[model samples]
Target: MKVLLYAEAKRLLSRSGIGIALKHQMEALKRVNVDFTLAIDDDYDLAHINTVGPGARFVANSCRSKNIPIIWHVHTTAEDIRNSFLLSNIYSKYAKFALRKIYSKADFLVFPTRYTMNIVRKYGVKVEGEVVSNGVDTQFFKKNEEKARQFRRKYGLTGPIVLCVALPFKRKGIHDFVDVAKRLSQCHFVWIGSKGLASLLPRDVREILRNPPSNVLFPGFMPQEELVGAYSAADVFFFPSYEENEGIVVLEALSCECPVLVRDIPVYEDWLQDGVNCLKGKTNTDFEKAIEKLISDKNFANELGKMARKVALERDLTIIGEKLKRIYEEVLEKHGKKDE
Candidate 1:
């Protein structure tokens, strides 16, 4: 089910004080008697249904045939846009009018972050939606300062550690991150993710990180359980990406009481306050300043770290889950299946 894809929708509802449906989809079939079904092909069970993505392209057609309410769990990529093909990729650019048509007809929409919301809004998609940020198991994210150091040591780092977790995606701005490591030579730098940069990085920097000049460690993509410990060991969480729906790691870092410094992005900005929840920087100069500022002002950095943790605590799924559950009930009600 869609709930299991990101793996939070169901958990969020189960948190106390939020009421969730006991059954859904096929389970609803058992709960109530139904005559015909209007289905989408995400699940191959429905034999008679339209098989379009977004389900918007066939909205006019579906509306004419059936009177069922629609609920869509949206995940937007550049492919969904009609204008993406303008450059080259077919999914990137196709038909702008069709894209607008889909947005206009959708009955209900879901969004994970303002970053995702902004993209859909580009095509004038307007509908009531909830900001269901990716959820993390807070009980499991406690910081392990000693474990962090040990992992640093195991990775061959022997200095203050800054950990960047992810792949070599250009939008993540790895080049910018490396530039920071170059400037801050006293402390160690660590990159953890799927691929190692041993081949890509300049030998001098790689050598320093690997052996001497201050201790830099690269332990490419490990299990999340180990990654959580790695996060526990680091002094700060640094993410300098250009695009992100919501930095799930930010929550993980804050839950672990680690200081976080990220690019001033919409998803981060919406939840974090500069100099308050976490430190944010935009460009080379901006990141340099944040790194320097957080490193030099230890007391200030600690204060900001506590602020970040507190902010994260305020939105624990235990509390925010109620909003999602309420929305789900309202959506089902619109189908003449539930009542006010």
Candidate 2:
């Protein structure tokens, strides 16, 4: 069956995780040989919508009118949107109300993690939900010695590198990242994200960027090819986000076999195990110690990296494609019966 794959604000989201997830969904469908089109006007048996904006609402309404099955991929939640940009908390309040109304219209919902599914259910969205990871392309993100070397040289980076890939938002724990960087002056702390949106950042977040520690560097957004090298060149991939539906960067880092350290948040409860595949920390102090441990003990770091790659293998694109194909068939079959 042909599917209409749609994402609103594609240009604005291209630098963010939601955009990366959407791209992964397209690639996964391709791997499974599913026929899909990005155009909203394209004729299709089913629609998989990736955003909750006005455009997404129009698409959902259109699919409803035509009796076409709709799969709403819930990538954003009010809880995760708060503390991000200027007035994000204010927007989140209204966003929750709008999301419930929009999501309730879905034939089914796809969530990046069970954590997100549970939270959305609490938001009064009773639509049937399936947990599908924002899978990574292990083949594309794997470590390359030449690329790693080039990345380091291009940036004039020296010493152990502590990398964090995220937008310049408060909720992403940028303040905490900077605090941790101050504690470890020996390591080079590189935050790879979009600086173009710095104007929209919260006042405190913008202030932090203005007077960051000498060891810290904001290299702005990097291309996907450069990101592969960033992960490979990093001594550790440190993510301290306050909330996430699913962290796609974590999977990318794991796929590259880079040792990862993340916040002890609910979204990671199922897949990430502290001192196992990766390390977890709840505070800046905890993160500082974890980074130090990973950097000092090379053998331990390598072991964690190896195990992390195994975890990435389970959520690889090929596997996610098979899951999506089954999901599509189930939705189509159910919709057909209802139509009859």
Best by lDDT: 2
Top-TM-score candidate index: 2
lDDT of 1 by residue, 103-214 (tens): 4554566565776777767767786665665444455667766767667667766666787775544456666777787788876777775444445444443443455334
TM-score of every model? 0.69, 0.98
lDDT of 2 by residue, 1-340 (tens): 8988899989999999889988998999999998899998888889999998889999999888989999999998999889988888999988888889989999999999999999899889999979999899999999888899999999998799999999988888898899899889999999999988889987788888888899999988999999999999999999999999989999999999999999999999988899999999988889989999999999999999999999999999999999988898899998873211
Candidate 1 residue-wise lDDT at 291: 75
Model 1 stretches astray by more than 4 angstroms: 1-70, 77-106, 196-216
Residue pairs with backbone atoms closer than 3 Å in model 2 (clashes): none
